[model samples]
Target: MVSPFEAGMFSGPWRSLLSLREDVHVEETAEGDLVLHGRWGDVLLRQPDPVVRGVLNRMSLGPISLSNAVSGHGGGAHGAAAVLRVLDRIEPLVVRTVGRSDGRLLVSVAPIAPAARLRPEPLPADRPIRLSRFAMVRTDGSGYILESPLSLHRATLHHPGAVRMIGMLARATTTAEALGDPPDDRLLVDALVLLTAAGLVVRGEHAAAPAEKATFAEDTDPALAAWSPLDLMFHTRSTLGRHDHDFGATYPLGTGRSPEPVVRPAADGPVIALDRPAWEEILGVDPPLSVAVEGRRTARRYTGEPVSLRELGELLYRTARVRSLVLRQDGEEPSASSRPYPSGGSSYELEIYMTTTGGRDLPGGVYHYDPLGHRLEVVSTDPAIVAELLENARTAADASGTAAVLLTMTARFRRVSWKYRGPAYALMLKNLGALTQTLYLVATAMGLSASPLGAGDVDTSARALGVDWRVESSLGELLIGRPGTSSGDTGRLPVNDAAWAERAAAYLGVKRGG
Candidate 1:
């Protein structure tokens, strides 16, 4: 049922009716009469009674109708007079229909009083007012818009005086006397009242009180702290379907060229062909999935022993090898390749690059893992750059040892952006997690040491790799080598549990062990 005026009117003296004896009840008779049974006695309004009919009809139409009926003689002069008298008696009562019973509408009547209107108080000449810290304001061609990040509230001020006043208030707190004189001052006071009611402004003294800053960190995932806003926005708008334009409208598969370099063997340059080892033989001696899972631990301290090139090749093939490529028909989607780890929209945007320091067969240089060719393409030969990369990997893993190999993960953003929107970057990160987990499990299965780093310096990696940061940039790092064999003692390696706990506590502002 629709409410007459959006809100119910308050009842005053009629509130006493609700406190009547518990046994008191109102029932309608088949003869069209209202019977009120109370502790004192029973009161009945007879059927066809003009006063009662008129009152009920006017009440059904709402208070506004009742007022109109009282002023007009449409209900007949005598009937109107009766309605007015009945209304006077129920002036302290709020009458409304609760529902319908059998064939008649049920009525609810209670006592209430009108609510008081808010009155604006004169602004103090001494105290200054400023916008709340939680409020954000911007100007458009049409007007000045005000919004509060703390709340989903927005206000637009189009009046020049209001805009000027808000601009003044935004810079710093100012009293009404300092805002200007006469009309401007009046407008400022009125605007202040409106803004105050909207929770956009606070008194300068109150705003100065120390309070925890309103932050999006409370709502955002901690793992996403490293994500840039531009990247996030691009990912969100491209994958989340929030943009106005149609997304995924066209098949994005073959739209853009692959960013991977074509590996044409150089005359003298090193291009190591990754041996395609038989997996059946490897699995015969490999531990069970359950055993592998249980044994998978992030190894921080590695033995100084160098990892064999065959082991590195096997690891890359098992975890990241492109199993098959599917090409689409004309007017259909383009082409996509499948890998062991699942990817967002089958857009395997993750690319692997490795820096080998003390590998048995691989030289100390930076190389890209060619998943399609099952080979490694040497990208950099500078010893200093390789040293820097190794140092970063060690720092990330928090281990002291000659890192046999370091894997740097980068993303080809357009691969996912072509078909997805805002959630593209997030999906890429998810793919990274899946790939990392796969690496951990496979490393365990192979009896190799592997440690996934929580973060890496993107700019430094980009510079060392000589790759355009926009096209591709490092997203994660992983260190791999032979596990240390020193009496099961991990030496000075960073403990993720403790570090993570400390960071978490700091973010939440909670004292540890408290």
Candidate 2:
């Protein structure tokens, strides 16, 4: 059916510049007149007076359906009710026709109330993610309602101008009765383009067009440059957030729709695996290291000793577990959003799992770290995966004697999806980086080797771990093992400050600082 917006445009009397012509010969003969041959009909738009052209050019109704145009011909096959279905998206307004122009329907748009603009709702700022809503109204002053993107509510001001132009082409009729069917793609695209050009509408990232320019700096490592730009951009933006703030939110349906997730015990065990003394030592540190300016980059190589299970437990607790709960003064209990480590939305969606290679207390197997209970739920007892795990990290051979392979997974993006809507992918990457760093620092402080592996057969490894794709697929792999000899393959490759300098130059487009 024709949308109300289209009907309003057709119920006008401004001017028509082009019409449809079917026959090839007709196009040849009607060289002067603008003839448009569409699936609906052969419409011929006559050249109008200067004032009329000015109004017609400014008044655009798009890309509505061919069905609507066919119905607008005043056919009697269907009653006004059928026509009303097409104009479902339109609202109430008045139409006028002068004596000689009786065939023309001049509709005038009613003004909107000021209060409608006062609702202070949060709008999406970034591209890709968008939040929108819609509604419907009836033609008989009573009919089945329709729904539309709320953006239309703000675009209604264009109604008066569009209706005036459409009135000139068709007879005055109810929104439903005037237009026949909704416009097809050919019509809709054209109309939408014009409407957008005229500032009557705007669209989010469309699949049809090329992507926009990069606002965030790109990753300069050529090895990574070929990876999806979307992924790179997401990571870059997330890294920046880590340097600037401790948390961000990802609420897909908005805070209004956020419901407390029912926490059920998925497994009963310590989220960490470690020897009794080592675990005690980790938890008993005089004071856990605080993330600070000078401490951010103090990463160290591992000597290949097993990382204590106790240390692993402490790392998980400090990085993601819920630390406390908060309440608001309004007598409403607002859940605390803080985590051991900062997150985008107080959503501790990152899950920690381990592939034990040679830990003192944990056996050679796979386990899921249950933070709520602080125990490891053994998921597997296979040694093959440990080999695959080493190859993925490009260090399985080197990490053999080190503790266990710690893998981090991100879930609950829906938490941020509640708010950011479209930017969930970017937000997820950001969370990974922050959590990876948290784990790295914790491992480093405890005198364990901390290496973050960015490349891996994530999907395959995740399946072996018995985790859902959502919880395990998107990840930032961090391997904790005994520190190995830096004299081996690590030194074979020529290490120079120049390589880092070039990468840094590409990242910030500036020379290295003193």
Candidate 3:
């Protein structure tokens, strides 16, 4: 449907000028007379006639009739003929009868011409301007939205004049001159300046590159090449510090829309009960938090020693166990449970799966960690799938030693998307970072080797676990095992390891040599 602003520009006076035929020809002859060949037949406009010259100059402002021009001078046959000749010089001219004005017949005359070129100087009152191809314009209920994707600039125009200006530009390229006198000259000029600065509008002869071709020419990532307008719009709008949207409301948990069960139940698979140790028992005789922080480093190489089932259980319990479930019935929002790690909106969305390569008292397979029950639910018994998962971890770490355990972290998107608008994926990423740090600290305190993987194959993990990629997708992976006695380098040491070690030792109150 056409908007009111659009109807005014397209159905009003501007429409007559834009709808003219393009084939009509106009040219200057050797005698300096302007010759036009159109539907009305050939005619010649003599430049020497003063009235004809005035009419031609007025045509630059828009279409004008010879009768109007000659009536002001003197209504004579000879002067009318001269004015008609000048009108014919503009190809594809049209004449229509209208209401009588001042007891004289009024004729509306329109002449079609090529769109005017954008000019660099202040727009002339007679010329028209248009939006460049790179400019994207749309209107919502509130106001008009203008965006230049190439320049990465956006503007929201709510003022009536500004909206009308954009509508005129869309209907046909027109200048401020063609718009006539403005209600507020300062406001009009300021709006135009801002639009010009944002690359939203162009005047004179300048032509901008098309948005699609320009975007493809500059974008480097192949994954992003497949993005659609909706994809980009969703990504930008949902992220923080952009346009405003509904936020901070504790949306009620609708009937049957409660969060997914905290833990997935194992139907018939073998459940390996996990031994949970108290925090006090685990911290006994261990290094202080400062020492643990100082000693924490990404371990790329393991000792080729098998990690015990008890150690795996301890790691999961410390980093991701569900501590308690809170239920509120005091007329406030619905209740939510709490976990060891922080989550956005108390929406603990992360779930853990593990692949073990025949660890002590543990079989080699893929299993899901039931955080609520503190047990492992067997997902797959295929050794090849287990091997592939461990291989991916080793490749990600670039280490020769095999990883005893590979932790795959996946997020339940609906948990956060239910309450949040745009920052759902961002919140998941933040949750992953917090979970990784928790793993790092827990591993450090337990004297186990741990390294976060930089990359993982999502499809491979999904196939091995028989989980739907759309429902839950892998976000991160971490390799955990016993620490090696030797240097156990993966040939990927930090460039400034010596300097870092010295600084770390000083901060931890230990001598460098010691």
Candidate 4:
């Protein structure tokens, strides 16, 4: 008995319908329509009313497996590693087919790549069974079933008019050549999405494993946390707390000095020059005077001059100021929020710290900037705090000198965990990057300098700041000063001095040289 699809192939205007590819010419015949005259099966487009179906003029595919790709160490022996091991042993394969204008049938064969290795184990008998393959004899009849060696997770039918499509794809000699039939990019993509989602097919491409980077959470210590404190005194001055403080119990100074050396003012600052003709040419088309987007050119060197307190205030305000109120309707009440920078959930978990040397009417002490009121709060007028801040930043980074370091601490995961559950770490890092970029742009516009530091000592820094261990701290150091010649730069540390700092902590018999 002819199937509904096979009957429809001959009875309907399947001949006039379009071929997915513009190059392929569609022809009618006693057997049906011809799409491609391949070595194996002939490809045909069968009209089944609403949805046109791509059917294999001949063939059937055997059992297939539905499984996730294994990656990394595979966790444990019984996890991904075990699964891939089993798949390697079975070595299941698929078959393909083609049709001709003369009703001639051709079939081909190919092997699936080793994307995964599975471990052999008896599947639970009571567990639900998974079907790997099925064939449609007709549009409405019970299709022929092909048992899958591995259970199928789920199944989806594309068009009731086409059953041979799955078999054609499964058995194809070359997956890419078969997919090349339908040239419509969007349609092809949609079809692929559907098949993959239903666990009916696998793509040829493979994805890379996730990245691994060192983080504060990986550190082993009692006082250490992801976040630490930022005081500018020692950072701006190139010295650790070589003094005493009443804040907490100080550990014996270690022999090793902080690896982080303070970044000194550039002697012959970065030189930036622009091509006048190129600048004018682009500007002539759509001149933007309000905001200039300059090309990547060396900026002119600066003669060191103390940045005024007013200028610092403006920089903070422009970059980290709360512009306007963001209101959203809550369950029963309306919530109004504010932020210095745009936030994913308005968590505003970032805290800003400032370390300065010289400014009119402001002493060279570390200060915390308050975004809410657009003001600076004095954390401690003591110069020793700056040393403490720099020590923390250097310890966290295990590197050298950075001027004007900003410390950001995460007080509570609950701040955003409720809205963005398990992925809070990713979101937090993104927020940090944004905050750094905002500061960088503001510094650029103000003719100052800034740098973002990824490494720092969170444990010691947190202890100094009197913050809880759970709070995560990060060092974002910015060096701001008048650019000048190398000879005249006072902030420039001698190479020997810089080297000495690295070993100072160990020499002092404590974590920091101070």
Tell me each candidate's RMSD, in Å, in order.
16.5, 18.1, 18.3, 24.2
Model number with the top lDDT: 3
Prediction 3 global C-alpha lDDT? 0.61
Off by over 4 Å in 2: 1-61, 64-264, 268-303, 326-337, 395-403, 470-472, 488-514
Choose 2 or 4, whichever is better by lDDT.
Answer: 2
Error of 3 at 172 (Å): 23
List where candidate 1 sits over 4 angstroms from the true fold. 1-270, 331-334, 485-514
Model 1 per-residue lDDT tens digits across residues 1-514: 2222221112221111111123335566898886555433565656635555544544443433333343443455566555444444333233322221222222222221222111224455445566665566677675566655332234556456555666666534545444654434343454565465444665544332122222223235566556554554455445522222235524345555444422212324567898777968775656656656655667777876777888888899999988877776663543678898998678888889998774556788888888888888888989999999888778877887765888999987766666664456677889999998899878767767688888898888999887788978788889887777434433757654545533432322232111
lDDT (CA) per prediction: 0.59, 0.42, 0.61, 0.36
Cα deviation of 475 in candidate 3 (Å)?
0.8
Q: Model 2, range 241-337, lDDT digits (tens) per residue?
A: 2111112453435557445341224664434443223446545542234422112232235445565666666666766555564555664755444
lDDT (0-100) at residue 69 of candidate 2?
Answer: 44
Q: How many steric overlaps does candidate 1 have?
A: 20
lDDT of 4 at 323: 59
> Which candidate wins on TM-score?
1
Q: For each predicted model, how many residue pairs clash, with residues at least 3 apart or on different chains?
A: 20, 81, 13, 71
Please rank every candidate by TM-score, starting with the best: 1, 3, 2, 4
